[model samples]
Target: MELTLDDLGVTLSRRRVLDGISVILRPGRVTAILGPNGAGKSTLLRTAAALIAPATGTVRLGDRNVATLDPRERARRIGYLPQNAGVHWNIATSEVVALGRLPHRAPFAAPGQHDLDAVTRAMAATETAHLADRPVNELSGGERARVLLARVLAGEPDWLLADEPLAGLDPRHQFDILDRLQEVARQGRGVAIVLHDLLHAGRVADDVLLLKEGRVLTSGEAAAVMTPDNLRAAFGVEVSVQRNTGGGLVCTPIGRALATA
Candidate 1:
C-alpha cells in the first residue's frame, strides 16, 4: 500500500507548520525526510501518521483516508516511533515491546502464541533479547531507543514511521538499525524516517524528501535529490557529494554556502 500526501498543510496553535506539501511514499523502499531545525519534518511525519490533523488536503493510505481508520485498525496498520520516546514507568523491557501487540489482541484476552512469537522476533531483531528482563527506566539511552523500536516492530505494521530513530545510538548500533529498516522495506513494508545525518540519509534512503520552511523544497530518488546544490539550498551549507567503493552516495558538509544578493 502506498502512503500519499496530497497538498498537505498543517497548522499548530494558529501557526502554519507545513504548507502545500505532497509526496508519494511507496512500500518496499525507505523514504528519508531531511531538513534543518524547525523545518517541520516531525510535523509532516505526525500528520501522515494521523496523530496530527492536517489543516488542508489529505493523507491517504491506498485510497483510504488515514483519519477515517479506526484507532485500533490504524495502530495495527501503522507503527510510529516518535523521537525520544520515553518510558515513564519502570516496566519490564519485554512488556514494553509486547505492547505493540495490543491492537491484535481480543478484549480481556491473554496474548496468544502469535503475539509471543512476534515479540520474540522483534526483540531478537533489535538485539534487545538480553535486556528483556531489565527495567526500561534503567537502560541506557541507546538501549532504550532500540527497545522502543522493537516495540514498534512487534506490531508488524504495513508502514513504519520513525523520527530520528538513530539518535543516541553508537555508530555500530546506528548501522544495525539502518540495516533493519532496509530489511523491513525489502519485506514489502513502507518505511519513512526523519533523519538529520546527511550521510546516513544518503546511504539509507531510496527516496529523499527535502523540506525547507514547512514546504517541500525538492524530492525524488536519493541520487538525484541528495546533490550538493539541493543540500545547499535546503540547509544553506556547502557540501561535497561522492560515491564510495560500494557506489553508495556520501554527503559531507564542507562549509556554509555564500549568500547571494
Candidate 2:
C-alpha cells in the first residue's frame, strides 16, 4: 500500500510545524527524509503514522484515509519506531517485545505460536535474543534502541516509519540496522526513515526527501535530489558526493557555506 500525504499541515501551541507537504511513499523501497534539526521530519513521520492529527489535509493508506481506519487495523498495518522511544516498564525484554502482538490478539488472550515465532524472529534479527531475560530498563542506550526496534519489527507491519533510528548506534550496528531495513523494503513493504548521515542515506535510500524549515526542498530519486547544490541549499554545507570504487556514494561535507548578506 502507498502511504500518501496530501497537503499535510500541522500545528503545535499555535505554531505551524508542517505546511502543504505532499508525498507519495511507495512500497518495496526505502525513502529517507533528511534535513537539519526542526525541519518537521519527525512530525511528518508521526502524521503518516496517525499518531498526530493533521490540522489540514489528509494521510491516506492506499485509498482510505488513515484517520478513518480502526485503531487496531491501523496499528496492524503501520508500525512506527519513534526516536528515543522509552520503555518505562521494567519488564523483561521479551515481554516488551511481545507487546507488538497486542493488536493481533484478543483481549486477555495469550500469545499464540505465530506471535511467539514473530517475536523470536524480531529479537534474532536485532541480535537481542541473548538479552531477552534482562530487564528492558537495565540495558544500555544502544541495546534499548535495538530492543524497541525489535518490538516494531515483531509486528511485521506493511509500512514501517522510523525517526532517526540510527542515532546512538555504533557504526557496525548502524550498518546492520540499515541492512535490516533494506531487507524489509525488499520484501515489498514500505520503509521510511529520518536520517542525518548523507552518505548513509545515499547508500540505503532509493528515494530522498530533502526538507528545509517545514517544506520540501527536493524530493525524488536519491541520485537526482542528493546533489551538492541541494545539500548546500537545505543544510548550508558544501558537500562532495562521489562514488567509491565499489560504486556506492560517499558524501563528505567539505565546509560550511559562506554567509549571505
Candidate 3:
C-alpha cells in the first residue's frame, strides 16, 4: 500500500509539531526519516500510522483517508512500533507476538493454529524464536526490542512505521533488524523508519526525509538528501561525504576546525 501525507500539519498543546509536511511512501521501498531530536520525526510516524489525529491536513493510504478507516481495519493495514515501546503484560514472548493478530481475530476469540503459525514465523524472521518461551519482562533490552519488532511483523500489515527501531541494539542486531525490514519492503509493503544513524540510513533506505525544527528540510532519494550542506545545516557539524572504494558513500565528520576555517 502507498501512503501519502498531503500538506500534513500537526499541533500539540497549541505548539506546531509538524507543518505542511508532504511525502509519498511507495510500496516495496524503505524510506528513512532522519533529523535532530525534537524535529517531529516521531510525530510524523504517529500521524502516518493514525495513532494521533493530525490537527490539519490528511494522511491517505491508497486514496482512502486514514482517519476514516475503522481502528481495527487500520491496525490490520498499518503496523507501528513506537520508540521504546514497552510490553505491559507479563505474557510469554510468543503470546506477546501473537497479539499482533488481534485485528484479524474475532472479538473475545482465542488465537487459533493460524495465529500461532504467524507468531512462529515472525519470531523466526526476527531470530527471536529461542526467546519465545521467556517472559517478556525478563528479556534484555535488545531481546525485548526484537520481540516487539516480531510483534509488529506478525500483523502482516501493508505499511510499517518504526520509530528508532534500531535503538538499544548492538551492531549485529541493528543490521539484522534492518535486513528483515528490507525483506518486508521487498514483498511490496511500504516502510517508514526513523533513524538516528545517518550512515545506516544511507546504506539501507531508498528514500530519505530530513527534518529540522519540526519542518522538512528535504525529501527524496538518500544520496540526494544526505549532502554535506544539508547535514551541516541540520546537525551543525561539518561532514565529508566520500564514495567508498567498493561503492556507496561514507560520511565522515570534519569537526569544528573546518567550520572555523
Q: lDDT of all the models against the reference? A: 0.96, 0.93, 0.90
**Which has the greatest TM-score?**
1
State candidate 3's TM-score.
Answer: 0.95
Residues 127-182 of candidate 2 have per-residue lDDT tens digits of: 99999999998999999999999999999999999999998899999999999999
Candidate 1: tens digits of C-alpha lDDT, residues 1-261: 999999999999999999999899999999999999999999999999999999999999999999999999999999999998998889999999999999999887899999999999999999999999999999999999999999999999999999999999999999999999999999999999999999998889999999999999999899999999999999999999998787678999999999999
lDDT of 3 at 224: 89
Can you give the lDDT of residue 72 in candidate 1?
A: 93
> For model 2, what is the C-alpha lDDT against the true structure?
0.93
Clashes of each: 0, 0, 0
Estimate, for each residue in 1-261, the C-alpha lDDT of model 3 and write its tens digit. Answer: 679999999999999999989888888999999898999999999999988899889999999999999999999999999988999989999889999999999999999888888898999999999997899999999999999999999999999999999999999999899999999999999899999887788778888899998888999887888899988988887878876674556777687434555
List candidate 1 stretches off by more than 4 Å. Answer: none
RMSD of 1: 0.8
User: Which candidate leads the pack in lDDT?
Assistant: 1
Judging by TM-score, tell me the better candidate of 1 and 3. Answer: 1
TM-score quality measure for candidate 2: 0.97
